[model samples]
Target: MRNPLSDKVISIEPSGIRKFFDIVSEMKDAISLGVGEPDFDTPWHIRDEGIYSLEKGRTFYTSNAGLKELKVEICKYLKRRVGLDYDYNLETLVTVGGSEAIDLALRAMINPGDEVLIPQPSYVSYLPCTVLADGVPVVIELKAENQFKLTRQELLDGITPKTKILILPFPNNPTGAIMTREELKEIVEVVIEKDIFVITDEIYSELSYSGNHVSIAEFPGMKERTILINGFSKAYAMTGWRLGYAVGPKEIIEQMIKIHQFAIMCAPTTSQYAAVEALKNGDEDVAAMREAYDQRRRFLVNAFKEMKLECFEPFGAFYVFPCIREFGMTSDEFATRLLKEEKVAVVPGTAFGSCGEGFLRISYAYSLENLKLALERINRFVERLRAEKCN
Candidate 1:
């Protein structure tokens, strides 16, 4: 038989986060703090809107870009929240999820041999999406000393004549690092000087525990060259709804919409209607959930501190990336041992990138009760590890 698989596809490994999550799912009495999913149900009013949409038979495919009303609402939400303005009709393309927007933006923007600068300890999809788009993935290792925020020097070092797109995964996953407005201004200068576009994934925008989430696109001269990707998943707790959107220059957005048009047709119609409701009337629900996540975030930070674990206080997202190097084990080895010995599951930081070695990403998206129970196990595990080292 002839060979059928693409070498490129075969070369890609599966997600390391899912590897542990699947194992924990099968293990009895195991608790997983690995996945970044929120514990909240989709807000009640949003669910009601979806049900109402179905009852009204609003089941047809929306325009490839999305429903006009939803697009307008997304624009309003962005402007109101982030101080960025975009034309709903000309600059926005609704996608199946923020994941799809990441993929679509890469496919639309990259040509073969183009280089994409990806900051490490970010969401897993960026590097692979660049590869699938036939672009070279240049990894920029973010320093823990800098709280994992990409710096101007680091961005400048990553750029080359071939560098075209920079994937800015701020309010970052796994690391929970966020760039302030001042920090972003430094990056903005480098990007403008280097003439590189950016795909800024801000899916966790509202989950930011620091001040308001700042997008690189919020900087002057950025909106035109930046594809801002966000969705209802992190903030609105609508992960399963499979809804997200991208906003950028009309030229770039038109290209993304073309890919989305043929591949996805449109985002789910009912989810679109529900998201409209979410944008219009779900602020209070989001605020309540944000408050809960903030409490859990603080609890995890304090728990790690009390355990004598070396962890930087992360200011965004519901994860804590604590250093596990003192245990004298690689991140994978430590995570594996913890799961096997204590039935407590967390992701190895290396899953995000090699730069994440010696760290583990523990999500606090679960309830306080679950977090407390898991922390007890984690503390016990750390005590045991320290005793072993002394021996």
Candidate 2:
């Protein structure tokens, strides 16, 4: 038989994070900090709304863009939380997850060989998605000295005539970095000058520990050129709901919706009703969960410090990117050995990008008790490794 697979699919590696997660799943007594999922359950009120929708026999499909009420609520939530106003009817399209919104946006915007500038040590999806969309993936390796935030110089260096889009993964995964308003202004200047569009993934916006999460879309002239992707998963503890949305200029949103229409039809009808409830009445729930995550974040940062490990202070997302270069092991070697020796699981930084080879991403989304235990095991493992090196 002739070969039938697209070389693109064959060449792309599976998610590196999931490799350890799968092993951890089969091991008893293993504490996994590998996955970036919230430990909290979907708030009672949100779950109740989904059940209520089902009880009312409202399980039919929604419009291609999604339920009008849900889209309205998403717009309202954005306005109230991030201070950006978008037209619900024309500017927003619901997606299966922020993941799908990313894929759709890339497919909608990218012509073959169009260059997509992606910052490294970001969420793992950006590069692969760009490649699958037939765009060239240009990586900007963010530095730890800058707290892994993308720099304007780096942005300029990555751009060329073919550059069409920049994937802004902030409150970044694997390396919890966030771009401030002032910092975003510098980047906006570059984007405007370059005439390139931006796809900003703000899924972790609500989880920010800083004063407030600022969206690039809030910058002047940016809203028109930016595709803002967010979802219920991180903030509302609704990962299983698989619901996300993207908002942008009407023209781009309409094109994305066409792709979404044929590929997904709409986000889950039941989940849409529940998300409306989440946006309207779940502020207190989000606040409480954010508080808990903040506490855990602090604990993990301090624990790493006490162990003499170099962990940058991450203010946005739940993951901490700690430099493990001192141990003189590859990120994969360190993570694999740690999991085997300590029965604890954390993702290797290399899973995010090649630039992450000297680091490890430990998630603090677990309970304080689980985090404490995992920290203890990790400390012991580090001590043993150091001792062996000395001997």
Candidate 3:
């Protein structure tokens, strides 16, 4: 009998993050700081809108691009927040989630053997999605000294004649690193000069702890060449709602919508209505949640500092990538031992990419109480390791 699975799919490994999440689920008293999800409940008004949509029997499929109202709101939110303008009718597409938008963008643009520049220690999906899309995945290893921000030289180094796209994952996932406008200007120059397109995933835009988040699309000559992807999941605590959107040159978005149409038909109608509420009036809720996340972020940074651990301060998203090379263990080994001995679970940084070795990604999305308890366990584990090294 012939093998049923596609060889391409078989070559890809499953998500490394999921393994620890599954293990911690069944372990008694285990605490996980691995998942990058908000702890806040969806704001009441947003939930109310979804409920109201259902009560009004608005369950029918929306247009393939999504509800016109939601798309317009997304454009408005982008213009108001990031100063980037997009045409709602032709340039925007609502997706099942930001992950789907990522996949859609890759599939829409990639041709076989086209090179895609992917910065390492990024969200795991970008690399594999490029592979599945038949794009060559060129990894750009971001440096710890540079705070993991992709530099102009790094971008240039990754580009070649066949380079077609650059996946810009700012307010990055595992590192929580954000690219400021100054930093982004350098990258924008490289992208324009190289004549390569960009897929900038700004899903964590509102979670920025430093200054306001900046979008590469805001720069001159960039909007035409950039696909901007964002969603309500991180900012509005609407992860389970399964809604996200993309905005780009209409030509690219048209292709993405075509894929979304055949594959998903439409994003959830109720979620669309709720997201409208989120964009229109959920600013205060986002601000409150962001403030809470900022607090937790600071607490984690300081905890690592007091433990004498080496961790760079991350100014965006809700995670900290702390170096664990002092322990002389690979990220996987250290994380495994911590889980086995202390019942504290954190994702090995290698889950993001190979360059993430000797580091761990610890999310700060949990409550203060849980973070405090988990930190205590981690501190104990670290102290024990230090003592053994001295002996």
lDDT of 3 at 108: 94
Candidate 2 structure quality by residue, lDDT tens digits, 160-202: 9999999999999989999999999999999999999999999
RMSD (CA, Å), each prediction: 0.7, 0.6, 0.6
- Across 133-203, the per-residue lDDT of candidate 3 in tens digits comes to 99899999999999999999999988899999999999999999999999999999899988999999999
Winner on lDDT between 1 and 3 is 3
Query: Which stretches of model 2 miss by more than 4 angstroms?
Result: none
Q: Please state the error at residue 76 of candidate 2 in Å.
A: 0.7
Instruction: Please state the error at residue 132 of candidate 3 in Å.
Output: 0.8
Ordering by lDDT: 3, 2, 1
Show the lowest summed lDDT stretch of 10 residues, model 1.
207-216
User: Against the true structure, what is each candidate's TM-score?
Assistant: 0.99, 0.99, 0.99
User: Could you give candidate 1's per-residue lDDT for residues 69-109 as a string of tens digits?
Assistant: 99999999999998888899999989999999999999999
Off by over 4 Å in 1: none
lDDT of candidates 1 onward, in order: 0.93, 0.94, 0.95
lDDT of 1: 0.93
> If both were scored by lDDT, which would come out higher, candidate 1 or candidate 2?
2
